[model samples]
Target: MPYEGPRVYRRDELTYNRYLKVEELLQLQQPQSDPAHHDEMLFIIIHQAYELWFKQIIHEMESCIRAMMAHKALPAYRRLTRIIKIMQLLVNQIHILETMAPIDFLQFREKLNPASGFQSIQFREVEFLAGLGNEKLMGVFLNWPEYRDTLQRRLDGPTLRSAYYDLMRAYKYRIPEKISREPDEKEREQILDALRELYQHPNHKLPVYFLSEALIEFDEYLVLWRQHHVLVVERVIGGRKGTGGSSGVKYLESTTSKRCFPLLWEARTYLTKEPQWEAEENEVSDL
Candidate 1:
């Protein structure tokens, strides 16, 4: 039965090209510029690659949320690590776009009117899933019903921040029932007190401690990406209005101050070793 002269393969066989749909992917880069400016191809490919990575990051973030809900700190932390690595890659990828000279970008920039990177639904999903949902942004997707619906679901769903606080509550931490971007002074104090206790006595809850640190790292890199992106945009366009009719660099600059987990950053202000106290020997279940 082992007598094969020449093995035959089917057209739909699982080869690398078929599995990845490489040919179809290559065909998607149709430049909008008349006669096809050379730099337009670069611009299209870079943004497409960004969408692909955003998809992956969203996948990982959803998994991280599930892990946190299950009270599995290690699994959540692992997913967050992957997300952080992908974000680092994205930060460097922006530099590659910077290689396209300002003059080169101008050649095809007009063709991109009303088609701004600001309309990236997946990026909005990432922000919403991170607990930074803004109802005002719903207007951006008004013309795209499908994308707007998707964003509506994300807005209604639980976020990574909510899941983290729920996990802390499950572990007997005194987390508030509600935490928002702008909490009252007493609410802020309560949240910071809980975080200070964790940082000061991490031995009591090492998994929570490590996972909290990972969340902060994720927040830090997100801000770093925004900062880098603003600098690159300023270098390229220099106060020019965006293709989507926004304030361009000024709008992006404002976003750099947004934090996915503001309490984590605020917690840093309260950390100190002077009044050291030992952690209690209470066991944290389901960690």
Candidate 2:
């Protein structure tokens, strides 16, 4: 199985830092201002690096979701696990961003003008792939063509939502035999169900309890991610409005309430031993 070419493997190429050209990657930091603004350079670099990491995360998530729908389960599972762990690395970045005091950020705040983390298109794409699917948010990237193309492609792709609904329809649900290019009531419901189930990561009384539980772990990590962001902003800049015109802390708090996987969360209220309480309350008191 080994047809090794002359360059089959250069030993140094296998080293930890070999693949990365530090000169090029590290040279991307151009702060757009004077030496009087050294901290701005640090701020700019950290955020730039964060965006790079976000790009990788988005790529992996898209692949994982695609793999799952294609019935290539193992690769998808591995990719998703990697994405969740990358989130931990993402949290560590806040501590780095937090080092810039509010005063430091203010020195170049004018330079930022209308730019804000709220406008990060890659971050938004991550949200969309995680099953949030709010394509209308494409409006946010209207000013940037590169970003618009990337996000619009994700929204318009033969999405996992469509692939999943096909699975459901085959099982006797009154759903479509395939995912449609246009939105449908049934397709939307199926997407919700798939997200909820995947995100909830429940402990079903089933043969493979571990798999069921890992799903819940995935869901929890995703939410933990949102919560972690809220806290990071709170710690870094208290109550200040974002440069992007968003009400900083308040906006992020509101976002944490929106589940990336709605069904996974809602199912708990309806699936657990306590689901009966939900029904009794909904019973005739549909009031």
Candidate 3:
């Protein structure tokens, strides 16, 4: 096989706007505010930006999952790195939302009732693809047929964690047989024990060790994004119930500690934090 360069054409052949559909994209923001409040445009654009990023994140995650299922660590690592970078962008993006004053948010907040971020289908898909799905969460979308159907597909689908364990098994790691949407303490302990060995004796199993840290970084950034989201919501809406009729900040507060990879996180606690240096070994943290 030969390497191919990007396709090129005459100067008038293809354009930036045509390639990106910029005009169509610009028209998609249809704010319902009758008077067109000043801050509503910002709100719409920010959310639209988020949805675009969410779509890309899903694209990257699906590729990563496929690679993991095929026991391809290098490709999985590449996608995981992209996901981590995108998630960091998401975490920082919350600050833009926080910049809107409560008064400005209230000017257009009423227009958003029943259309909360909770209804973000892609975000829910992200959660499911990342190994965080359950019937209770799926039930939240049951009232809407389209949303429920989408969620139902994810509920019945494969998850990143499941694929990861399969990858570990392919690599000859002694991972536990039991896998669940919500793993029990015993099941978690079994997985954690495997992780402990990987962390302690990482030199020989370099690829598995790389994947483990990638997963941990992914989980860590997810937690950060959720925490940042909670703070942004609290800043904008205070103690008010969510426009979607949920407990708002309180609900978000409760979910901040949710880990998509619980065993990977718990495994960290058992690690000997003291420096273990090998001059020839590159720092996995750099990945």
Query: What lDDT does each candidate get?
Result: 0.88, 0.62, 0.84
> Per-residue lDDT for 280 in model 1?
40
Ranking by TM-score: 1, 3, 2
TM values, all candidates: 0.91, 0.71, 0.89
Predicted candidate 2, C-alpha RMSD: 8.7
**TM-score of model 2 vs. true structure:** 0.71
- Stretches of candidate 1 off by over 4 Å are 1-12, 275-287
Predicted candidate 3, C-alpha RMSD? 5.4
Query: Per-residue lDDT tens digits of candidate 1, residues 155-241?
Result: 888889889988888778888888765678887788788888887777678889989999998898889989989999998999999
Please give the lDDT score for candidate 1.
0.88
What is the Å distance of residue 53 in model 1 from its true position? 0.6
Q: In candidate 3, list every pair of residues with a backbone clash.
A: none
After superposition, candidate 3 runs with Cα above 4 Å error: 1-12, 272-287
